[model samples]
Target: MTSIGIYGSLGRMGQAIIEVAPSLGARVAGGADAQDDPAPIAAKADVLVDFSAASALDAHLAAARAAGTPIVIGTTGLSAKQHEAIDAAAQEIAVLQTGNTSVGVNLLARLVRDAAARLGGDWDVEIVEMHHHHKADAPSGTALMLGEAAASGMGTTLGEARVTDRAGLVGARAEGTIGMASLRGGSVVGDHTVIFAGQGERIELTHRADDRAIFARGAVRAALWLAGQKPGRYTMDSVLGDAVLGA
Candidate 1:
């Protein structure tokens, strides 16, 4: 059985991962969060999974390094500098980072890419997402990622084509623009959809995250898959098979 470290052990997702430990063949060696140093607990762990705040990453990385533990980071909202830090640390240790952990979400992103690659630019692409009111980010990292997936497939960059949520009487939807919209309310975990609109018909692909456990399960699966990987930056796409994603 793999001994796991749950950074942000007190948070909703962390506790949820711990709750499903048995079925995944894992044991919580220890954990840490903003309120406490998971070091005391994480010391015994073999793989450290950081799901804590982006702010706490420095401490988490230091501790994981000292423990000689490979790390899997699930925290989103990281700046370019923060990503630099994570990438720098990966030179000395293994690190897996993802904007979202749901296998479905990653697969959805790949599907969006495939569709964009097959369809002409005339088929406008748009993304919509809904999450709990507590979420801080406007677009939700997953939404932006999906947009990036489509943009990448079309041989362009997202920054150039993105049409974020609109206000006022925003003119008409521009051709070739990848639009993004967001919704917040109640205790929603997450929901995402991508629409490909063409002159003749439209296609929609959606993923509804009814519970946070789905994410936790994906994280655990990623951790296990990373256990034997060569030290480097990794994503959920690498953990899951190509048969499911086709990319």
Candidate 2:
């Protein structure tokens, strides 16, 4: 059995991971959170999975490195510098990181980009995303990633085309602008939709995550899959392998 250690034990995702670990034929050796260090618990595990905040990634990665354990990071909203650090750490140990862990979400993301590309440049692509009220970021990382994929598929850079949130005085929608809108409400887990709007016809690709456990399960699955990969930086796509997408 693969021994798994979870970082961010007290959070919702972390608790879900800890709860899901046992049934997946894996053992939870330990976990870490704001109040504590997970190194002691991680000492007995073979891999570490971090579902913590952006601020906690450094300490979690440090503990995993000291223990020489592979880490699967499912946290998002990290800056470019932080991403570089994670990639560099992969050289010493295996690492897997993903913006969204729901298998269905990953699959939908792939299809959205492909559809955006196939639909042609004339179609205006806009991403509409919503999450729970407690979320910290304006555009959820997943939303931005989806937007990036859409822009890339159409041979454009998100930085050049992204128009997040609009106020008054904006004229007609700009051509080629990858628009993003966010909604935060009661307890909604997550929702994303990419709309390809054009003359007479429209296409929409959507994914909704109702339960947090789905992400927790996917995270555990990723940790298991990462154990077999060679030491290097990887993504959820790598862990999914032939399962790179799900319907």
Candidate 3:
């Protein structure tokens, strides 16, 4: 059985991973919280799964790198600099970082990319997402992930095509732009919808996350897949190939 280490042992996602790991034929090698050192856990496990805060990413990556261990990152609310760090770390250790770890959400991203590519520029793209009230980020990372998918479909980057805010007198929606909106309330696990509106019709692709366990399961699956890989960056699509994704 694969031995998995966890970087955020006390959080909901971490707990979920621990609960589900055994059923997936994996055992917890060890776990570390915010105040603890992760290097020890990284040293012993076959792979590491991180669900910790973005602020601790560098340390976690460093620990994994030092131990020559593969790591799966499911943390959200990351900045450009943090992504750069992950990219840099990938040069030495296998690292898989994703905004959301739910298998359904990753599949939705694939579908959004395919639809955006085939729909043409005349179809306006918009993304809306909601999470629990305690969540800190606006325009949750998953929203941006979907926006990136839509933009990629159009052969454009999210930076160039994304429109995150709209106010009075903003005028007509810009052609080919991907709009985003974020909502927070109650105990919502997560809800994402991608809309493609054209002249005569509209298409909506949605994914609703009802439980955190789904993410935990996907993360563990990803960790197991990543354990034996060569050093490089990866995504859920990499973990779930075209056959599994039904692509």
List candidate 1 stretches off by more than 4 Å: 243-247
Write the residue-wise lDDT of candidate 3 on 1-247 in tens digits. 9999999989989999999999998999989998899889999999999998999999999999999999999898899999999999999999999988888899899899999999998899989899999998888988988988998999999999989879778998889898999999999999999999999999999999988999999999999999999999999889888765552
lDDT leader: 3
Per-residue lDDT of candidate 2, residues 1-247 (tens digit): 9988888878899899888988987888777778686678667788888888898888888777787889988787898888988988898889987888888877877787788788888999888889989998768878887888898788888999999867988899988899999999889899999999999988888888989999999888988888777789887777676756442
How high is each candidate's TM-score? 0.92, 0.93, 0.97
The runs of at least 3 residues in candidate 2 whose Cα sits more than 4 Å from the true structure, single-residue gaps closed, are 244-247
Q: Candidate 2 versus the native: TM-score?
A: 0.93
lDDT of 1 by residue, 1-247 (tens): 9988898888998999999877999888767777787566557887888888888888887876676678899987777888888788787778899888888899998899999999978899989999999888878889988998999988899999998868999999888889999999989999999999999899999999998998999889888878777678888877887754542
Clash pairs for candidate 2? none
* Backbone steric clashes in candidate 1, count: 2
Q: How far is candidate 1 from the true structure (C-alpha RMSD, Å)?
A: 2.2
Candidate 1 residue pairs in backbone clash: 30-41, 32-38
How far out, in Å, is residue 22 in model 3? 0.4
